[model samples]
Target: MPTGTILVADDDAAIRTVLNQALSRAGYTVRLTSNATTLWRWVSSGDGDLVITDVVMPDENIFDVLPRIRKMRPDLPVVVMSAQNTFMTAIRASEKGAYEYLPKPFDLKELTTIVGRAMSEPKGRPASPAEETNEHIPLVGRSPAMQEIYRVLARLMQTDLTVMISGESGTGKELVAKALHDYGKRRNGPFVAINMAAIPRDLIEAELFGHEKGAFTGAQARSSGRFEQADGGTLFLDEIGDMPMEAQTRLLRVLQQGEYTTVGGRTPIKTDVRIIAATNKDLSHLIQQGLFREDLFYRLNVVPIRLPALRERLEDIGDLVRHFFMLAEQEGLPSKQIDQAALERLRRHRWPGNVRELENLIRRLAALYPQDVITTSLIDQELSQPAPSSLNGEDASQNLGDSVERYLNGYFDNFGEALPPPGLYHRILREVEYPLISAALAATRGNQIRAAELLGVNRNTLRKKVKDLDIQVIRSSR
Candidate 1:
């Protein structure tokens, strides 16, 4: 066994000496740097198991230097140290890719443990998700957000740790989980899924753990459950938030012990399946409500991925629509064309149901719209009468002219064969600009200063537009 190598970058000689001795004592090789330039050099071409660098290194600020360093060593786990820690600085550092941020004067034991964990972490290209047997349900989007998701999924593929996916309903949480299993190192193995909420309270355990013949009234012959079926690959538990409390205890024990007997069998059957659980509800809150187990929560949450909602990443809608359309066309449906107007209309609508809803809408358009044009007018009609039962009255339909104008205004609306008249352009632009400005402002927590920076305009300019367009800003937890 080779010892781990740690790169220590700090301006203070005392701190460097202390870390070096501490790491050396813990059976690690220590490489030292006194400035950001040397730190950058080591990071550029050198390989180290871990990096511990001071935020206020001489020659350059860590924040300004990190972007380039990240480009060189993208998977490198970095721990940032700072004597002057502020919430903003801490957030910025973590957001940039620093694995952990520690305040100055950290304890030796803490340093040793954190460094050890970082070194042992899985690194390199994550396994590609399992190739779809049927490409009809492909995940789409080339937006920066989707690209980020791809990067994360790729990294996760390198490790077989349990993963917990959190997203609102209709955000395709299951799709993300499936992607993890498909591209991961376990792709060749079976992938089994079950809904914890869908099963009756008395049956979740039986659904997970196989039952021997005569285990219970209906247990004729032996039965294998999801865990057994996915023993060599992945087992996905959806709606985990709704899992029964008693079943949660059993599941937690199985995760910790890695072996479980069938419902009525005496001998234990070991499984090597990777567990991927998802939920639309907030599990943390459930834990507080005493309906979930803390130990179980921590075990399954070894890796957490937060999926962004469709409304949160509207820029990707254009690509998703096209992907869904391609899928529909492959199914023998006539290909549908969406002009810039229809695309914009889709983007501006608050997608409460997220990408899944968008996919359904696109498929409906492909299947039913009379003409290949798929005009904005058709979209308006569909929006007004859409899955009334499914949406359950969350639909807030805009007036007819405004809806038509919103779609016709965007540049990409040209894709549809029948374009809206030029006269509607100015009004629609104002409508689009007003809502966008309001949304950004709302996302910034009503901070006029931050909102202007995000909108790429002067504060005074944003203020004038807010008044001119009658933008109503709301407070959001941005």
Candidate 2:
């Protein structure tokens, strides 16, 4: 039942023919062109109901014509197709008011569906264009995983929806969040980030919602919170799963009411911050343990984006390596080129620490190595050595004690010339207990009796710990 004229433009006749055939089969009248000028003429003449155009044309770029089309025929939805398939390409398409951006070589069925949806949907004004910038591309990679992420990010750039990004550590969750804020409608607003794990649990509430001079025993001057600072912008809550229950409650209230009160302050302060929360921990597991509020999770997970680990997208390693080298060159490091064999070795190795680990290795190769070309042997040598404990990617040879000691050392080092907030003993115990108990449960196949016996604790105590720590108990018959 698809009706109306579909305007198709592309430099390639084959592509135009294919689109014409597909759109005609979909029961739509199709007019085809090989350049943007014809598409613009059709739109300006009010001849086409929907416009499907390639990014680059022989005569004029579709991007240049898109804004004019939007101004002249705002109701006509324009679907942009491009073979470029870069992060910036998707962004540009969205910015130019394209209803949807389809990376070339896309499925014919998907294209038809998008056209149908666009045609049926109420005609509304597209998002207002944002100011252009050539800031450093924060994201790189063209694997299907990355392409999907780019598409999702492009659609989200104009909206203020809350986003929850989940992935392993070093998967560039913060980079994605930064991209969201930097390209979003609130680009002019401040982007404030607070790590839930880094701050003491007791201070988290005050840190998030500000504190009056007499809020607590500190009796310090009034301090503004991240919410206040990120007003009209974005607030990225990293390690959100580590947020304490009290802080979670306060955060839930803010999300619900769009207003909050400072500690010891009676006046309510309204906020307009787009919350972008990221976590490596399984929040559903935390919710099962009664540690995280389920209501808050739904509020922040309005747009859930799970970033793939570097291991999941090995095809992107070459691009990532080149990007890192370019960054290193910009930093005045010795220029380095990685050989094919070296890149193959990288692809074979398990990237346990994800992209961050790879970036560090690249930096080391660029800075420490004397050779212009990185070789397989050099890669093997570096991969064989134990990752430094400081990088938090220690090798398997490192025992729990050594890892704990290194962590404590770093924790203390972070507070040089100062003392850490109180309740360190309990916090450290909880941190150690979570993994230990989770491991025990896994070994026991989620049998509480067996796990408790293994841990030399009573079954009730083990149950309490499990619930308190928010460790997900996956039951299996092994």
lDDT of 1 at 125: 22
RMSD of 2: 10.4
lDDT of 2 by residue, 218-273 (tens): 95799999999999999999889988788898899999999999999999999999
Model 1: per-residue lDDT, tens digit, 1-478?
Answer: 3388888999999999999998998889999999988877777877687789998877887877776666677778878787653333444455456776666666678778888887787886221222223223345654446545654664566479899998887788878888777656787898887866444557778889979899999888998888889988999988888788988988988999998878888898888999999888888898999989989999999988888899888988887888888887887777778899989988878988688678778866765444677778878876876231211122432344454556445433544565432334454465357556766776676666688898789876886776454343433344
Model 1 TM-score, all chains together? 0.56
Q: Compute the lDDT of residue 140 as modeled in candidate 2.
A: 91
Off by over 4 Å in 1: 1-138, 386-478
| Candidate 1: Cα lDDT at 17 | 96
Q: What TM-score goes with each of the models?
A: 0.56, 0.80
Candidate number achieving the greatest TM-score relative to the actual structure: 2
lDDT of each: 0.73, 0.85
